[model samples]
Target: MSGGVDSSVAAFLLAQQDYDLSAVFMRNWDTGDESGTDKGCEWEKDWEDVQRVCKKLDLPCQMIDLSQEYWNRVFEPSLKQWESGVTPNTDVWCNREIKFGALLERLPAPTTSNKKPWIATGHYARKSWSTTPNSPHTRPRPKLLRPSDRGKDQTYYLSSISEEGLSRALFPIGHLQKSEVRELARKHQLHTAERPDSVGICFVGEKAKFSNFLSSYIPPNPGPVVDQVSGKTLMQHAGLWTFTLGENARIPGMKERMFVSSKDQLSNTIYVVPGSDHEDLYSNTLRVSDFTWIWNDAIPPDLSTPQGFRVDLMHRYRMHSVPSTVRKAETGDLIVTADEPEKAVTPGQIAALYDGDWCLGCGVIKSTSR
Candidate 1:
């Protein structure tokens, strides 16, 4: 449950429904402070909180350490992506690989034939069923829907999960708003009622910033920071991994606020342009690889033809989707061109496409064009 209010409430809701249920705390990372001193791991505290909540709910809970799995599956690939000057969204991989893939496999089978074992999570997304008669397979398909809580919809993060994994998944609190979740926790006297939301829990804890966590793994390259327009060196930065596209370039002794325009991994240079509205930061086209479509295995024929699929592409979580036309590139990668030039079409980040409220698929952004 991660000792969080949302998860606690999710468990409670599932229990109240009288479904055969059990709790499992998946320990993914080992953040034992790189110094190797007596500083305890934050996960230990989280584990304790999970144990307490499971006890309160009168549910059997067990801990499964998946540090190696997480390292191999999520962390290593993320570091490689960062090293190549592409910002990766590690949480997407975590949710698909560990939470749904590995942990779900460990869940005990149902004792009765009538009951089905499902791995439920606290994600703010909903799933619906539909049938596609026009397609080759005319069976019912599970479609990933946007949550009723509009602002809290997390379908973008979960776009990469397979249809099979999603079929066995359940999101108990997707229909409720964040306030309602907190209220439910408070009403039940759960310990996490007042606990604040944990941001970026996949890579780092509440105390450790992402830059600090990344710095521990990737040593500073100390490269030059250049201007995008003039190609003139502005300053020196610790490393290319330290910053992301569209983030402010906080160069010491600089007078004006500037935004990151691009980074050259070969030259070890960061290019910056003044102001958030800089034209260099926006891209008209982006290439995406490692595509996963939940609805259909093959790309829609229209996308391959001259008449491309008009889709809304979401590159980052919670950000509004951009109206775009998606087509298959000659190299087999998916090419998406925004209707209007969009800002920070980051490489290695997931490009989640949608048609109206239904999410079509997701892919890793490979490159962008200005």
Candidate 2:
């Protein structure tokens, strides 16, 4: 439940059903492993909250530690991507690798009428099953759909999990808005009724503390911060990860506000433009590789063809999907071209596809160009 109101309401809503339900809280972060202190991530308190919710619902609950899985599958990969001068959405990978992959695999086999053990989370995403299967012999396939609350929909972060993995999942409060969830929690007198939403990645803590935390793990590689228009070096940067595209350069004593237009890892330099709306900050095409379809066999029929597949693509969470065409190369990589230019489509970020409200899947963006 992450000691949050959303999960508390999810457990509450599911408790009204006849099916068996037991809360399993996964602890994916261990502060002991990091610099040896519990500052930001408080898994113990979250476990306590989960237990309280389960107790109120008259259900059993247990805590499972998945820190090792997170470190290997999510953190390590994110570190590598960050070191390469791109920030990967670790939350997206955490869902695929830890919550759905390792933790789901560790669940005990169903001993009851249900053939496979099902997992329900507080994720803000919806799912549906189709009678038509990918192949005649296979059962109905699960489609990841957008939640009713578009503003709160989390289908983007959920696009990487396999179809089979998605089939065994449930989202109890996917239809409700954030306000409705808070109201429901309050009506039930849940302890977490007023708990504020958790911000950023749990282990990473607040945004202000992020660079400091990352510095502990990554050695500084000094680089030049240059103005894009003038091609003049303004100052030296400790690391490229310290700044993100389109954000204020935050350089002291600059008369006009400057924003990062791009970063060149090869040149070891950060290019800044004078303003946020500069054309240099946007791109019309993104290069992707290792594209993973949720239903691996269900690649769009025309994706590998010259015409490519028509799909709406989202490169960042919470951003509206953009009209795009995705084509598969002979080398098995993907090239996505957006109908309109997009701002800050960075490398190592996931580019998820959608056919209307249904999520197809995602892949890492290798690069972006005009």
lDDT for each candidate structure: 0.84, 0.87
Task: Give the C-alpha miss distance for residue 237 in model 1, angstroms.
Answer: 2.0
Expressed as tens digits, the lDDT of each residue in 1-370 for candidate 1 is: 8878888899989888877678888888765535464247667777788888888889988898887888898889889888778898888988888887887777777778655478889999988988775466677778888888878889988998988889888999999999999999999888989988777664376534878878878887899999787777888888888889999888766667888988889889899998899889899898999888986654577888887989998998888888999999899899999989988878889999998898888999999995
**Which numbered prediction scores highest in TM-score against the true structure?**
2
C-alpha TM-score for every candidate: 0.94, 0.96
List ranges where model 2 is wrong by over 4 Å: 35-41, 131-138
Question: Which residue segments of model 1 deviate by more than 4 Å?
Answer: 33-39, 113-116, 206-208
Give the Å shift of residue 148 in candidate 1: 0.7
lDDT string for model 2 (1-370, tens) is: 5678988888888888887788888989888875597665478788888888888889888888898999999998888778778989898898899888998888887678657788888889898887443445366788899998899989999989977789899998889998999999989999898898888788766888988778788899999999989988999998988888778888888888889988999988999988778999999898998788988876677887889989999999899889999998777789999999999898888999999998999999988999
In the order shown, the candidates' Cα RMSDs to the true structure are: 2.0, 1.7
- Residue 141 in candidate 2 has what lDDT? 83
Worst 10 residues of 1 by lDDT: 30-39
Ten consecutive residues with minimal summed lDDT in candidate 2? 131-140
